[model samples]
Target: MNKLSSAIWFRQEQDTLILEIHVQPRASRNQIVGVENDRLKLRITDAPVQGKGNEGIIRFLAKEFRVPKSYLTILAGARSRNKRIAVRSPRVYPDWMTGSIQRALFKIS
Candidate 1:
């Protein structure tokens, strides 16, 4: 979970859960890998060029969580693959949302 370039809980205005994500842009596909000591590993089908990876991240999560991309915003690290995503708009996440979110972004190790 630590490898995650970014992780955050929805509607937690204070003491919110946040993670640092490391995106493997232009991966063969989209998947999530579990915590490996420090960083969260993520694989995306979109190419790393032109913010595709970043866009893909939002798309993937929106689909998985059945939310709109507008609901999920990249708070930081837009230019860089490592980003801080904040779950907003919807204000609610599904059960096991974190695990599902990770899986949506990376492959299980």
Candidate 2:
């Protein structure tokens, strides 16, 4: 594991990146709001009714990580604000993440 994996918000396992996220639905905008209680915080404009928030999270994360929506998965907390996501072979890391994480994403083995 790389140094960033030790962080509670995210970890890298093989080619997959696992993220611990706390989402606040029906917010003023859709954006990453840093970490809270060891999980990455996010504010989404979509309401939490009828899985709209979950879909919104997937769409937002897909764009942030530069991955296809099919490459993203909600591993846990689909029915709640707290969620765990897995990104397979992500092409890029969001600028909000630490610089080390950004470098790690493109590091060749």
Query: Considering every candidate listed, which one attains the maximal TM-score?
Result: 2
> Candidate 2 regions off by >4 Å?
1-6, 100-109
In order, the Cα lDDT scores of the candidates are: 0.62, 0.85
Report lDDT (Cα) of residue 16, candidate 2: 98
lDDT of 2 by residue, 1-91 (tens): 2323325688899999999999999999999877677788898999999989999999999999999999999999999899999999999
Alpha carbon lDDT at 108, candidate 1:
31
Kindly give the number of clashing pairs for every candidate: 19, 0
Residue range 1-109, candidate 1, lDDT tens digits: 4433333322244533344556787778887654433444567889877777788988976775576787777778888866767655444454434554666457435
Residue 9 local lDDT, model 2:
83
Give the top-scoring candidate (lDDT): 2
C-alpha RMSD between model 1 and the true structure: 7.4
List residue ranges in candidate 1 displaced over 4 A: 1-11, 14-19, 36-39, 89-109
RMSD for each of the candidates: 7.4, 4.8
TM-score of candidate 1 versus the correct structure, residues matched by position: 0.63
